[model samples]
Target: MHPALLEIARLGLHALPRASAGALRRYLETARPRLDLPPGEEIELFAPGARAVLARAFADIHHWLGQVSGRVPFFADIAQIAVPRPIPELAAAAAALPLLRADAPGHLADEAALAFLDRLAL
Candidate 1:
């Protein structure tokens, strides 16, 4: 996995609610067999479940951020992560964020996802 992507997962997971984070961890644990496969193979086999799991995580993180920041629009507009893609694709997107836009919305969302993954020690 890309180092930047891993960092983003770390950030994202940290931003999630405790329950949501725990749930994701559990999912990862159960999905370990599929997750251990090579990137493309794992995604091809696990995309559906991965998308569902990640979508829930994203929504929970967004809600949590809104509650804490009191600026739903900021998160909604900037950090809204679409869940149609697999982790590798998402990680690529996170890796693609420009250094100049480190504080951009996508970056925030990426961070949240990274944090979540990091919490799982992924």
Candidate 2:
């Protein structure tokens, strides 16, 4: 990682209140695309039930923004994870606020679909 980005990840983001981190996480998710399928492939990828799960999550972004919130509990099931860096499954969810804020077409819909089982519990 770039020293500057690492430093900011530590100092810049860490300098803020806990609420800031929470808000930033939420905003990053909102910026991301809800799924990974191509525009025309949504039908093949997400069944009506699965799409509803994401719709609900999108509708409730403000209430559960962070990956850890369990509002979309499926996101928490990273295939593999360790300290500092997130697992590959959550790479997009790992984006920071500035990048996500500027991204017009973010990618993470697969993650949402993976979490659809949990959506029923919401």
Candidate 3:
């Protein structure tokens, strides 16, 4: 993700109330940085159930986000990560602030998604 977006995510997560979905839309727009992204490259992809998880998290409904979403946790089943270069890491860290630790579970997914976007952007 771009450094600018990372910064946006971090700031928003740390400051904004997750209860407000409207904040998320504004965050997405404000996080947009000027970039010459290449053509034919998919910068965003949503896995099945991603947005619902986000909605629950943002709503502060952790148990539902975990329960209604499934019989068992879906995202928790995967575990594999490779660290990027310092520059990329820095950029990702900045661009992915939306998914910061302070965010609720729903918002957390958004942060995770943005983290992926951060990598692709770089």
Candidate 4:
């Protein structure tokens, strides 16, 4: 488990399935500090080749996981290869989380997001 997941579990231990949207934000913020990743910045950088490398790697693992899914056995019982995300996306996502209000009315209460977030933290 990521440190953030553990923190989230500790945060919502009492609430369990009923943990609120604020918990999600707290989890994101908690996870953010340990990331040490560079912000993606949405292609704002001047460098072309290096930026492409970062963008392609980030997209391949996170945004475009589905495109690379079946080319190899994404469904296999064991993961033969593990692709890591670029530093930029990690930094960007963590930074952007604070801008969104976790207490907002439309937030989801699903645990699936927590699991996905945990993976993102990885």
Candidate 5:
């Protein structure tokens, strides 16, 4: 991971609600690949190009998260898990909502995910 991304992830942990932070830490610990190969061997599997692509995607997601952090009251829900939609689409939907109340329904996340899909087609 890029150093900047690592820093963002570290800082982001501090910003999360306690339960959400703990859940993310636990998930990272348990989701590690069980590769038996030596340290260098595992690193060799990923080409530099592939690593760059992954890093770009990670950065995009983090950027989108930052963009919506203040706007979405239930950001922790989306932050804790990866949404399937593209970041651009997610961002457009989030930007469309004038305000998302703290007590908003969980399904609003879904609605936001689809908000910009059609717009992107234009």
Candidate 6:
């Protein structure tokens, strides 16, 4: 998370009433679709040369997930790739977490795999 953004989110977390499940649910329901555009819309809306559209889409999803849930659940849900933010650094960290304790060191050697991992670290 960007330092400035993280700080702002942290402040919001502290200010919000934790027991207000209705409020939280409403917020999330409204936020999710707004964050991720309708499928087939991104490329057409952004134009053919918008090479980074996927990255921006994912980032919004990541931000919304973080806001609705705490960090642990958010990251755990992200591990499944259900909500891809495509932020390089975040993608890198997410990719590594699953392998951190595994003995499968050979997997990271592939050039394409390495490049994918590198993005999560950004």
Any residue pairs clashing in model 4, and if so which? 40-88
Please provide, for model 5 over 7-119, each residue's C-alpha lDDT reduced to its tens digit, 9 standing for 90 to 100.
22243366555554444344323322321212321222333355456555776676677677754333445432332322232233233222222212322233322232222
Q: Give the TM-score of candidate 2.
A: 0.22
4 or 5, greater by lDDT: 4
* TM-score attained by model 3: 0.23
- State how far residue 25 of model 3 sits from its true place (Å): 5.0
Model 1, poorest ten-residue lDDT window?
A: 99-108
Those runs of model 4 whose alpha carbons end farther than 4 Å from true positions after fitting are: 1-18, 39-113, 116-122
Deviation (Å) of 6 in candidate 2: 12
For all candidates in order, the CA lDDT equals 0.43, 0.34, 0.41, 0.41, 0.35, 0.35
Model 3 deviation from the true structure expressed as Cα RMSD, one decimal place? 15.3
What are the per-residue Cα lDDT tens digits for candidate 1 across 30-104?
Answer: 332332233443232234456567656777777878888888754654332433434454444343343313333
lDDT string for model 2 (71-95, tens) is 6544454222112232221232223
Q: Model 4, range 1-122, lDDT digits (tens) per residue?
A: 23223333443444444454455645554544444434432313233356456545554465345455644433342231232333333344444433323422244445654443434331
The candidate scoring highest on TM-score is: 1
Candidate 5 residue-wise lDDT at 51: 47
TM-score of each: 0.26, 0.22, 0.23, 0.23, 0.23, 0.19
Regions of candidate 1 where Cα sits further than 4 Å from its true position? 1-46, 77-82, 85-122
Q: What lDDT does model 2 reach?
A: 0.34
| Alpha-carbon RMSD, candidate 1 | 16.7
